[model samples]
Target: MKEYIERVTDGEDLSLSEARTASSLVFEAATEAQIGALLSALRAKGETEAEIAGFAQGMRDAARTIDPDRRPLVDTCGTGGDGHDTINVSTTSAFVVAGAGVPVAKHGNYSVSSSS
Candidate 1:
């Protein structure tokens, strides 16, 4: 965690593997301060595609599996950090899709940068 914080603070992008490991650490071991610093640094430096993918994979790995009765499912989620005060479009879209008889699996952490 400290290594990730230091590396990101130095504006050096982590390799996909590094990002993955760091993300795993975030869920399993990193302190709130460490997570905050890492996220801030990544935001300041702008996350790369590999970093995003690796982090997403790490989160997916840590998530609990849900069986949907073998039915098709869709999720309406955003990358967040939209920096907007507007309504959450993804959340609204999920309801709309569900109302239209489609299965929706909307999920995300609370926004840290926006009102949504």
Candidate 2:
């Protein structure tokens, strides 16, 4: 974890393996503060595609999904870094789009910092 933090401090991007390892630590972390710092650091540096993929994969591996007997699925998403006191525009847009005969499975997260 310290090594990961150091690499971010030096303005270096994480490789796929590094991203996976660091993200896996998020679930096994002993404290919440460490998880916050890890995410903040990655967001501050602007996650690369490979890094994002690896991190997402790690989360996916940790999650359990059920195969529901439903129609085919369509998913759309966005990671919000919008300013304070604002609603999620992407989710709203998804609603509108889905209402117009499109399927949308939208997801969001909390983003407290990033605006300069």
Candidate 3:
């Protein structure tokens, strides 16, 4: 993690594997300060496509797979951390779509930045 932070802070882009390793450290063993440093470094250095994909892979690795029986599902997932302080419409939209006979799957996490 420190290596990643140093490299990114030095304006070096991480390769896919390096980004994946860094993300794994973030999710598994990184301290809060290390996480913050890495994020700050990445933000300052600007994220690359490989970095984004690698981080996404790391997230997938950490997440539980839920294979729904239904096929052709609609996912209405949001981060809820946009810092807009606006009302969330994802849940309502999911309900409306379901009412209209469309399959909708919504994420259940609460807003992280502002009240909805």
Candidate 4:
């Protein structure tokens, strides 16, 4: 799971400051036993949209980035699904938005599991 997290954040070029902030969050959120249980529960039951959205908001609040003067910005994200049979419509949507003159920040991951 740590490896998965590292891969997901690879492009962020996380600084020592960022690492410290994440470490603080982890320390504050769970004891060792609770952390283990949380991971197990998520793996078993899958994460809810609210949980994922909350995490995204938390990361945005914690990290530093260009403000773009409060201009409209859009992010396109996909919740990976099972099976290789599905084509990436979400990935295509990002390009379509960019082609339509909207600024988009797209995020994606390589399929690592058969269920992804």
The best candidate in terms of TM-score:
3
* Reference-based lDDT, residue 4, model 1: 86
Q: Give TM-scores for every candidate, taking all chains together and pairing residue i with residue i.
A: 0.61, 0.54, 0.64, 0.35
Q: Give the per-residue lDDT of model 1 (tens digit) for 1-116.
A: 99888988998999999999999999999989989999999999999999999999999889977667747778666645577766777877888888989888777777656555
Cα error of candidate 3 at position 90, Å: 9.7
- For model 3, how does the per-residue alpha-carbon lDDT over 10-59 read when each residue is reduced to its tens digit? 99999998898898998999999999999999998899999999999888
lDDT at 71 for candidate 1? 71
lDDT tens per residue, model 2, 1-116: 87887787677999988888888887677268777777788888888998998899888877656344444545666555655646666766888887888656666565443321
Give the clashing pairs for model 2: none
Better of 3 and 4 by lDDT: 3
lDDT over C-alpha atoms for residue 107 of model 4: 70
Q: State the weakest 10-residue window (summed lDDT) of model 3.
A: 64-73
Clash pairs (backbone) in predicted model 4: none
For each candidate, the alpha-carbon lDDT, in order, equals 0.86, 0.73, 0.85, 0.55
Instruction: Let me know the TM-score candidate 3 reaches against the reference structure.
Output: 0.64
Question: Which lDDT value does model 2 have at 82?
Answer: 57
* lDDT at residue 76 of model 1 (Cα atoms): 69
How would you order the candidates by TM-score, starting with the best?
3, 1, 2, 4
| Per-residue lDDT over 35-93 for candidate 4, one digit per residue giving the tens place of the 0 to 100 score | 46544544455555544555565566665564556557678777455556566666778
The best-first sequence of candidates by lDDT reads 1, 3, 2, 4
